[model samples]
Target chain A: MNPADRALEDLFQEVGPERAPSHLHARILAQLADKAEIRTVPAPLLARWQWILIGLAAMGSILLAVMLPGNGSSTGWIALLMDHLPDMTSISSTLRTTLIGGAVISGILYVLDAQLNTRVRPTHG
Target chain B: MVYTVTHRILRNDMDAEEATQDTFLKAIRGLHTFQGGSRFSTWLYSVAYRTAISRSRLRRTEDRSLDEVEGRPGEPGSEAQGTTSDRRRALEHALSRLTPEDAAVVTFHYLHEMSVDEIVTATGLSASNVKVKLHRSRKKMLEILQEHLKEEVWTLRTE
Candidate 1:
């Protein structure tokens, strides 16, 4: 830029763009605070107790399933299917217990995932 | 910075203020979409410029009959009133008379000292377009100041 242009530009520096009103700054901060409040809140502890109770109920049900009589006394599809199939009586007891434990743990995880998704999940900036 | 950009483009406080608020909110909401390529401030100004321009366009389209009741937003010399210096007043008056985009471009270049590339990144305008706007706006403002001040001065004409 030439001297004239530089001088003209300098004049702009003497008086810059309009100053925003103080209320506008307060208003912006208020809105951001409102947003943080809405999004950053943690879920209540009562809901945490509910989740613990649910996990206990699932564990108790699994224990009941393991202790209950097998397909022998019942007449459902499993009983009929087991009647035709070769028995898992030949498998090791420890392996059968491990398989049952894995299935139960997977079911617990699925339920927990769904519950966590619907309820409070932490967020990052 | 965001407010100033919107203020120059919109030429009125209420709309410019609205646009400035909208720009920040939009930036917050859409921040995840921003890649790390540009500076955060540049990305922000990009959002601000687009929001202000779009709002300005919306205002124009909605008011096809025009809002003549207000009768021209703020006049050139009207805002320059309280300034302590005559030259500053003259420049403000001259800047106000340019097209809103040109005024904003000049303000970005002169007041903010933003480079042509930064302007292009912020405004989505081509580099040449920004250059042309700056060059023409500077020349035009100089003309306005010299002519206006010269005309206002008490002079004696020779025979």
Candidate 2:
């Protein structure tokens, strides 16, 4: 830093930190005492185990569908679909499209939520 | 420190006080997850800075210039401004001329003795961005300081 910059820093040092009000400390302590009981805020809607089970059920359904005996175009298409999981032109087109659409929309919503609600909730703990 | 930053940004006692409370509470709760990676003060400062920034955005009050002295607004170094030296008033005026974010950056980098990296962590700004802000703010402060000094000289010469 140049002398002028250093001098500016010195000026800031001179300015110093502003004093906080005396009551703020007391107010915070009282609020903390009140908030102590509700520290363990459970995630809303789906519980952890519930989500895991849902994921497993979806995977199982997909596996069962892939294995079910099929005739005609599905035979070769399933093999191709397995290779290209995102291929939406198979017998499982409706299911695949719905699942993929849901996932993508959920992801977009999640990102939007994260971005828009950057406001720190009063109880971030 | 938390109160100081918030007061500087919000320029309002009620808002700053509320933000200070929030910052302290968040810091206390977050203390458990603090893995001793950085100094405890740095971490606390980061929480304070974020809380202040958040509160400033949330606050609906009209913005005031840095040039506004304690009881007086607009007139940077009016007679009501009390016993502070002219240079100090000039610095404050210059500081107020910048955006609130830049003022906070200058405060964190200089008054608080925080490193560029620390500011980046505190403000969630990139390292390069912090450095650039510091550089630009310093230059602006220098220019403001010079103009203020010249005005002082002119006032004294007339007196």
Candidate 3:
């Protein structure tokens, strides 16, 4: 910048009020604490709505299967159906337990994604 | 320090205090992602600038209609009186009329005394952009001060 412009800007040095109120530092620190609290906040469990929906779906499916009329023969249609659905029954109980465990993991992930989305993205909030 | 920086931007003590708090909160939340690419002070200033800008924009938007009698938001304390105060107020009034980027240039250059390189790093603007902003802001400030002086002279003559 030119010397004249430099001098003009220098004039502003004497223009602003003195340092902002001292309590400002304490206030900022307090706010920082609040933010840390928010960031460290543990995520909430998955939505109760999701659990309710899954429960309702499972119950509805079970009722529908039981309510369906079956041939009244000695063929034991229910047993035959269960036998044909080998993929569901053949897995070790341990593997089945692991598959159920994945639901918990995915639920946590879903909740965390929702929380971060709401907090970080203003449009979503 | 946050308040000091924000006060420079907003020129309103209460608003500055609030903006300072918000800036620190934002900084804390994003602290994990703050790579050490720039000085901590510069990064902090950038955060403060953004917070203050957002707040003032919100205020302006909320009170959009000019007929709403937008009185100055805070009291003009004794701290903001005298020739020093008047000159500062004059500069501030003019500064408020400038764009946020322009006001930022004035603040960073004059109040912080940051060099061109420092400003470029702080604002993420190219050196040429910084120079252009600085030049334009300085010229605008000169015109503002001249108009202020002219008004003062006119007032004196009438008296």
Candidate 4:
């Protein structure tokens, strides 16, 4: 071997990582579990509080749908039906009541989702 | 196996056990994004390195001095190499003086037996940089050990 290579070999023998204490691996693994790729959400996603926001949005939509005159049975998309159906006075009262009930159920779903999320979150940032 | 990543981070056998658990927890969660390009161990090492560095930083800040200084075997000047333990200690002492980054490169190469290319992937350093660092770091370590050995010989002759 060249002098440089030989020197390197000798040096490696002196200050190599193998001499490091063994517990370092375990410490690293523990830290990783809490913070990195293994977690349910990425750090950025958790930071944004996206799950909470999504839950809130779902609840709001359900509320609007339930309180509307049509019983959420409108032919168009639920949001659009809720918006335009108010103009249709000819709709039956029974249909409107059913739609209102459905909206209430949706709102309940959102609340449940929010509660689940709150349970799963880390306590101390 | 004796020189594995796990042992390096936490010296206490118990502490090492806990750290290994933590490392796997972190690795499993991040497994999906791990491209198949690198060895699992290499990727794992990066995670381990980050974890170790963060802990070291925290410990330093809290204690106002590094606490992991006890395991070093002996000063490089000690030429007591008749025993395996002596040589090992000499190596550890010589390594302790290196900057953490240089120490890391040396470890990856020697302890893990990683190639320059593997180290490049693991450390995210350019291949040329790895070569340069490895070269310089090795040279410095050898010089330190040799100087110690020479001093020891001189002392023996004088005595």
Query: Among these predicted structures, which one has the highest TM-score?
Result: 1
Chain B TM-score of candidate number 2: 0.76
lDDT of 1 by residue, B1-159 (tens): 888888888877899888888887788778788998777877887898889888878787554455455434433453334344555556656766787678878887888778898888888899999988988887777777765454322121211
**lDDT (Cα, 0-100) at A63 in candidate 4:** 59
Query: By the DockQ metric, which is better: model 2 or model 4?
Result: 2
Scored against the native two-chain complex, candidate 1 gets a DockQ of 0.27
Please tell me which model should have the higher TM-score, number 3 or number 4.
Answer: 3
Give the CA lDDT, 0 to 100, for residue A92 in model 1: 36
Structural similarity of chain A in candidate 3, as TM-score: 0.32
lDDT tens readout by residue for model 3, A2-95 = 5545555666677753476778777666655544554243444546687667556555554334423341331476656645544433444554
Clashes of each: 0, 0, 0, 25
Q: What's the alpha carbon RMSD for model 1?
A: 7.7
Chain A TM-score compared with the true chain A, each model in order? 0.47, 0.31, 0.32, 0.37
Query: Using alpha carbons, what is the TM-score of model 2?
Result: 0.58
Write one digit per residue (lDDT tens) for candidate 2, span A1-125: 65665677777787677777888887888877766333443333544465566556656565645444342345566666655554444556566556556555555655555454453334522
Pick the winner on TM-score between candidates 2 and 4.
2
Interface RMSD of each: 6.5, 6.3, 7.2, 8.2
Q: What is the TM-score of each candidate against the true structure?
A: 0.69, 0.58, 0.55, 0.51
lDDT by residue for model 3 (B1-159), tens: 556556655656788888887877778777776789878888888888778877877776554464257754322334433366566666776676666667776788787777888777766778999988877777676665655644332132100
DockQ of candidate 2 against the true complex: 0.24
Compared with the true structure, the alpha-carbon lDDT of candidate 4 equals: 0.57
